[model samples]
Target: MKASKVLITGVSGFIGEALVFRLLVDKKFIPVAAARRATKFQGLCPVVSLDLNAPEAFPAFDDVSVVIHAAARVHVMNETASDALSEFRKVNVDGTLHLAKKAAESGVKRFIFISSIKVNGESTPPGKPFLADDVPAPMDPYGVSKREAEDALKQLGSETGMEVVIVRPPLVYGPGVKANFLSMLRWLSRGVPLPLGAIHNQRSLVALENLVDFIVTCINHPDAANETFLVSDGYDLSTTQLLRQLAAALGKKCRLLPIPQRCIIIVATLLKQKAVAQRICGSLQVDINKAHELLGWVPPVSIELAMRRTVDHYQDKQTK
Candidate 1:
């Protein structure tokens, strides 16, 4: 029997790149990488340039067994675009629908979408975590676009009989990471004393390796079809704890002042950075019980190990 061919979009991204490596190492699947720009890819697999916005970018899906859609208009802190929502929908919604239609027409068996936890909501109510089945209350344009794409994907799957599996993950951390996670890691590396000590709010996070593992499992799992799942490190941590752990991983002592959370929020509001402040100080936890009961999947890497790998990679990059 031949290995099934899996199409991975956004193959150059941090999560996508990790997923690609996982698929390549598995003898049961062949990963076909697709991205908007030219990626080095290290000649690991067949690379194809795909423009999600272009109808002509459709793949020869006849031989493809699965489509793992990872490309999307992600969140931007300071978006200067004229219409942020429209820009996001163009690629995140319209482009996604176009790809799914082409894949369905070409007889692809499964479509696995890598969604974000932002689709669930930004922050959870005190002590209560966000569940997979909870109603969506998107707080930002990026989240709104993701919710739209998810709805469209499920509808398309229902009409076309394509197995659509949605996996919504929180902040993902690991080697070659970027964005806020990268900034956090860089800050920890400096061993600077900060004023985030009073933060005891729980926030969920997933390691890059663990997320890729879950995605690989969903490829052919019968139970994963048409189901949405949320994943994490099987552990939630407070902002202070996370910073301390990160400092430990970098072999530095974390210096955190026990500043009041209310004070921090007030400062953020004054600076017009309430959203940013909330991310650092608010609680956003996810319940992964659905994923556990349905897929029998667990994150392979622990939080401590994940942090070590992340810091090590950061150190290596700095040296190079």
Candidate 2:
């Protein structure tokens, strides 16, 4: 079946950009990209400026058959709890509800929400990854807000009969990615000795391309309706392993020192950097078996390939 018009919020974001490109190239979905400002999108798509906080900022959805809600205030340290909660509610929850309501009124079919695995908490216990059915225990305000958004979307689904597909993804990185992960790559490329070599913490991460593939698949997948799915590259990595892999991708030797976890934690606490330490030393992993079984979806890109692509993108940007 041919897909009707699709609307995507946060088109200027990392995942949103990649998803928009994929939709334009592969699925050929009629793309409508929305952002707060005018910017250059890689490919041609009907771009619209919409401030999700305002009720009238949402565009007319009468022609939109599917809505991919990807816009969110997604910074870990830059935002206060109150600010983050309000922003998340405005964009992720309220904006989502607004779109869903319009879609239902306009006879739109699906609403795909890009949620975070942080909703399951900062870390999973030993020998167990977060399952799809686990009760949400978000550690920070961002996660809490995302959890609220998910609930709101589900409630909207129940109320309006619009199909809601919630995709909870972990750290998504690749070309054009930002945040601490990219910072680590830059540090590693400079041959800096990271003290996280001894910290054994497993974290799940998804590649941008892989995540975009899943989002595109979910757009029309019948099993996605009213279901929440955790997505990953299906590979878990420790801090040391991740650093080593990153170093390898950059063709640089891993200059890592085996630092004591206690010492690191103590220093971080004394320096009022507990959040940074938690991110580097936490064990957050997700089990994506449900996605595989339900949607018959699997990551087409390998971890090594994903990291390599990221390194290449960074290098090219540097040269430019």
Which prediction has the highest TM-score against the true structure?
Answer: 1
lDDT of 1 by residue, 145-257 (tens): 99999999999999999989999999988988888778877777786678898898999999998899999999999999999999999899999899888888888878889
Q: By how many angstroms RMSD does model 1 differ from the true structure?
A: 1.1
Using lDDT as the measure, the top candidate is: 1
- Please, what is the TM-score per model? 0.97, 0.95
| Number of clashing residue pairs, candidate 2 | 0
- Alpha carbon lDDT of each predicted model: 0.89, 0.85
Put down candidate 2 lDDT per residue, 1-320, tens digits, no spaces.
Answer: 76578889888888887778887787568888888888576348688777777767566775788889888878567675556677667766677677677768888888899999889888876558999879999977778878988898788789888899999999999998888888988899899988978978888999998899899989888998899999999999998899999999898989988998878988999999987787788788899999999999999999999999999999899898
For model 2, name the residue pairs that clash.
none
- What's the distance in Å from true for residue 113, model 1? 0.6
TM-score of 2: 0.95
